[model samples]
Target chain A: MTDRNPMKDQVAIVGLGSTGFSREGGASSLSMALAAATEAITDAGLTAADIDGIVATNEPGASGPEAIAAGLGITEATHHTKPTPVAVFSLLDAARAVFTGAADHVLVVTPVVMGPWNSRRAAADPWRRGARSGILPVPEDATMAAAYAAWASRYIHEFGATKDPFARVAINSRTNAAANPLAAVDTPLSFGAYEAARMIREPLNIYDMDLPVDGADAFVLTSAERARSLPHTPVLIHAATSGIVGKNDEDQLDGLHRTGQHVVVDQLRRTSDIWIDDIDLFYPYEGFTIITLTWFENCGFCPPGEAERFLREHWNDDAQRIEIHGRIPVNTHGGSLSEGATRGTGHLREAVHQLRGTAGARQVDGARAALVTPGGFFFNPQGAVLRTAT
Target chain B: MNGNSEETDEETDDVLIARFAGNGITRDSADHFRGRLDRRLLMARCADCGRWQHPPRPMCPACWSWNMTMDEVSGRGTIHLLMVLHQGPPATGVDYSTGHPVVTVELEEQRALRFTSTVSDDFPAEDLAIGTAVEVEWIERDGTPMPVFRKAAS
Candidate 1:
């Protein structure tokens, strides 16, 4: 990767909004998107007319840019495109749009809905039944989400690991989630509770996977120069990148020794001046408990196969969450595991909140810099560093 | 081998696509599925570079050569990854109550070249462990041939 990152700290996320997250089946993806979009626009102290660019994510069942723009009553936009799901793809597009002057104010909206395939409550709803039409009637296979469980088995086999590390990840998110009203499952989780959870996929119980929920998270980004006048303290995008390698097919991966997570760490370390030693908070995606454990190892928080040991050493027993070096908290807004899956948008939004001193009860004291690594191993591994404007 | 007529071959292609529609059938991988009809496990191999790839790609990733062909693999390998699904998509002969085993095997033909499938019904569940030697076994699924793995004879 090239060291030429002129966009570093050039763009700032000045506004943030979320519809929270819930497993209850009541809202449509569009309605949630519009709700978050309007809230974000208001938070940014800007009217709809100020948004000249839109970057909507094509999350399953999510609305496109035109629908979102029309919903917000914005008539014209020069730069509007629908990037693939997950938060960073849309964030990168919007940030690049603002940095290059393609648009002065860009809105990145990501809405996630619990589809019929994943949730029984959704499957029973008539509106969500449409999502079941195109799903392939294939036999059981280890791909996509299943691939994580399949590989989790490999991790345990290779390292002789027990369920403690994965259970700690679950407990940590639950502990943090209790402080945030927006979180879905805020009930405190204990080792016994996690171990007792029914196995949806062996080696990975129900607690191991992210909760499928209906929610949306939106952000308003503009050039750092323009962000100074915004109502909230601007959270500057220090260095952002997505990483992948060839042969990324889930089952075809080159073992746990290397993955897209490794590539992301390599790139971020090279580009960002603020390394892990400088960050006050960490938000590694917990779409799967295994993903979070790997992030801990891949980010150099600990050596490979030592997450269980690292977590045990650094875990705050009273708080029931991980605080690296007893300072940098992991997933302070809970995570996909407990916060409901916004597919990393929640991580980005919480990072912004912490940096701006708006995280309320969960805010890190005098938080200045944060490391947010989102997405998973095979397809969508992404990382970004955010810091308060100087 | 009996249905070798050109007209029958054309019909067979359409039939194969429809039968394995859930496999994400494409021109690049159609031949690999066709091999399954004869109980043969075919993986893509580069004609120019001899590099092996799975889930069949049209061009060789190693050399970017379009000259690739589906060649039979010995189907003898060790399980590299395994997961027993307590719940999953519906399929014939799969009883979730007992749990279903899905594994990706590291083919003896090439390192890191893998294929994902279920294990045979009679395969001892307790014996299913990663690195266990296995060989392909054909079974009927929805009136079509499906390849699974069974513990290889020691």
Candidate 2:
């Protein structure tokens, strides 16, 4: 729980690129990775020769660092490794590499592809069918995606909450998605439509889960000294951390009070000077609606079990989205719920765009700081504070 | 209290691994699965400190002690977490069309110690609520003994 942060604002995200997202599922994970990786390198005003590091994420169907490097013609990389999925793990690894002089310019590429396990369309595709060859089908269980539903029931039982807060998370993302071209489902969601959505897991309907889509997001990281010459406003990494408790197994977790989210908030608050009140944009992961609600409570935006009321109070009725304190916009990029589950990469990319004043219609005016909390409570709960160079 | 008449206690490690192909059977957890064949719900308990753990581990998490034992539990607990799945992976007896109910129960032996399984068919779905008392009940799935839960007698 030390507040020591020597890396604070030392590394900057110099470039960002994305293949957007699509449910149509025509491209392979490798192609998407290459596409986004190349675009990101070009966006950073660098070439393959300049990238001496590669940090690829271990997404199920995605390519590894070796494959990505070979595809991009990066012949020599001193620092190349595959971190586990989710955006910040790779971001942190790349930032540390650049800071420690392992590489001057590091590229982080994360690709998400619909697999046969989650999507029926992907299951029907012959090429995707092979992806499940080694996997064994198990009986019904409350793990992984199902764990969220299990915990959501506990949250409702313990708090005596209605479905309003969960519905709001979906609707808010949908409303914001309408303005972002990168979003998959841009159709504005209404409270009635959310309530009427078919229930896939009890207490959580189809709308509650993130959509499985094909996409990739990539970022370029370099020391702050090198970022000053970049074209876009350098979004500095103030503090980044991933947290987890000992008994993190989905069903065995110590109730809602203490979780990885709490650990992350504790560490981030200690390391970063900017708190939630100072941020103009919020990107709490919405992989599950309940996750979004809990992040609000854990991050101290409001008291526990009061998200429904807090959201209702601060919700901008005219915009149909959350505007905390009538100013700070949440998930301005539509988030994983509507942005096709780039698995927190969309949240990171959107935050970078907004902080750089590049987000066309979705940008918050004069947005300077962003608080991005990505991943869920179990294994990958993570948080990072990004802001323009002070 | 053995669930199946055909299953014998002499099954080899290879045979046991083949039977529960996807249960993630490892040397540390093989004993737990072996107990399942005999209608026994065995959980790992630290021999040194008596700390209990589920989904067995090679060493005790609390004290890092190598001495551990697979001991039977009373299987009596209250439903701590509940999820009704309207869709899921294909299982022998699970009919997702009717919305399969899966629950993780907090065992009476220790707080926060839990085991996850489906409820027995006899337990009415309407009565399947969190905090309800439940006990282990054995049922056959694809000829393999499977442990489920049923509402405990008041």
TM-score of B chain for each model? Answer: 0.91, 0.90
Model 1 has how many clashing residue pairs?
A: 0
Q: Rate residue A70 of model 1 by lDDT.
A: 94
TM-score per model over all chains: 0.97, 0.96
Query: Which one is best on DockQ?
Result: 1
| DockQ agreement of candidate 1 with the native complex | 0.75
* Lowest lDDT block of 10, candidate 1 chain A: A132-141
- Supply every candidate's count of residue pairs whose N, Cα or C atoms clash at under 3 angstroms: 0, 0
TM-score of chain A of each: 0.98, 0.98
Across A95-122, the per-residue lDDT of candidate 2 in tens digits comes to: 9999899999999999998888878889
lDDT tens readout by residue for model 1, B1-154 = 1122244466767888889888877767887888888889888898889999977877788999888887899999999998888888888888888888889999998889999999998998778999999999999998888889999999
lDDT of 1 by residue, A1-390 (tens): 234788989999998889888988788889999999999999999999999999998788888999999999986898999998887888899999998899999999998888888889998989987784344456556678888999999999999999999999999999999988888888899999999998888889999998888888999999999999999999999999999888898889988999999999998988898888999999999989999999999999889999999999999999898988899899998899877878899999999999999999987889999999998999899999999987
List each model's interface RMSD: 1.3, 1.5
